[model samples]
Target chain A: MEIYRYSMYPLGLKKLIVPCRQLQAFLQDLLESTDHLKAVLVTDKDGVILAKATGPDLPDHVLEPAFSATFSVASDQSGKLGFGRNKMIMSTFDEDQVVQFNYSPLILTLLASSKANSGVLIAAGKDLEEPIKIVGESVSKAIQHEHKAKEYV
Target chain B: MLKPKVITQVLQQANTAGVHAALLLNPDGSLVSFAGGTEKDAKVLAAVASNVWFGYERYGKPPAANSVEGGEGKEGLRNLILDCEQGKLSITRTSRMLLCLVADERVEWGLLKAKTRTLKEYLEGPLNLVASY
Candidate 1:
């Protein structure tokens, strides 16, 4: 029975869950720390929103697909620029600022007020290193599980 | 209306400010003028700048909410900075064209921003002239 359970858990039972709650919680904490921040979004390369946290003034749907489009397009073109992989992109507008990070297999976008200190926001993004690592590992494991399961069937 | 002399002046100022290379490009990423960098890198920068600007315009800006008074989304894009492993790429929008700069690790972010502001001001007239042409 123990061996059977081990075979069933080939993908590692510990890492199977996507850790959606942890990501949401981290984003929520990040949002609360700064009023200047409007929203935080985590998405895959395909523009699928995996986790998000928004301020009271901003609605969840406010982001739509525009944020994803911005990051995806920039990242794709960035590679051709021969600067190696892009680390971060910061764009400032009239009233808002958008910062996108190339987390590989995942893209992290932060929407903030134009008035916010960009240095602080960039530091906040750097703080996500640990969480991003965990999330990346879990997501990779989930994908591996799906593939392995398909092979079994 | 635009003169090669004006582009040279701006590029010279940028080089003095510690930028390794710079390129002046149209919104579509066509090279208007280039200084310091290899031709291949300049072309790539122009293409990337255009794509990034297009993406920001089309998707990055959200629609203004009906209830959100005084909120507008039609404002012109100010600039874009991409921090990469190789170095930093800063693209600023002038009245008509894009100014792209590639700086090495020796350049500080604050210093770069300050220089970029001045470069943008210097390039505005010439870039606008290019647009008019």
Candidate 2:
């Protein structure tokens, strides 16, 4: 429900600035496009909430950033064993609530009911990968821009 | 000591379904049993997994640690799955124990994950693993 805004560099590759407005619009489209997703939270490597969209029955407390941060550590380690970098983490909690996470230039936390189709949830996460990259880069740019402005003042 | 044969059977069963390796660990990360990997590999898996379980239990809050007294099963973490470029890993837990499965990239994960409860039962029953870690 609460969305955090940040400017992260995309995969730490190309440096580009994506406007915060664009990020919000992308989140909106993702929500409308996916019927099964109950909520989505975007966070940085530190597990700080950047931007999020929530549906019914979701509150801030349930969308903890600390849990999301651990995935990043797992992701980094996975790449070391000659395996590719980690793409996502899926956890099924009690009563069939399923949570899926994707780590990268951005970390995505998704929640859905136990009855929701697993395929649909996975596809939805894949669909948002690009948009999240751009949004993440936008956050980095925002922070950098703020720092620059401070220097001039 | 837990029966090695039953633990081996469970690991082999998991391997049949494509979980290349599996292990049981105490909350502190000591190796209880392992299936499908070299001894060195098993040690690596145990070391990393116990740390993960410990961190999650100690710091992952609101839902808090599942081991916390009176915490509902649904309140905290139940299972965790990760898909990396090369392979996949899944970790499930009890109050005092952890089950980690390390599988190859081609594994049929959904089927394997669906059977985690049965594996946990194997640990608790014939394997005689203590649940109070």
Model 2 over residues A30-51: C-alpha lDDT tens digits?
Answer: 6667765666677777777667
- Candidate that would win on lDDT: 1
DockQ of 1: 0.59
The lDDT of each candidate is: 0.77, 0.65
Residues A6-84 of candidate 1 have per-residue lDDT tens digits of: 6655454356344867888999999999768988888877778878898887755567646776687787778667767
Q: What is the TM-score of chain A alone in each candidate?
A: 0.84, 0.70
Residue A16, candidate 1: alpha-carbon lDDT: 36
Candidate 2, chain B, TM-score (2 decimals): 0.76
Kindly list the per-residue Cα lDDT of model 1 for residues B1-133, writing each as its tens digit: 6677767666766875568887888888899888887888788778878888778776677554333433455555687888877778888887778888888756777777777788899777656665775
TM-scores for candidates 1 onward, in order: 0.87, 0.76
lDDT of 1 at B95: 76
Q: Lowest-lDDT window of 10 residues in candidate 1 chain A?
A: A1-10
Report lDDT (Cα) of residue A128, candidate 2: 73
List interface RMSDs for the candidates, in order.
Answer: 2.4, 4.2
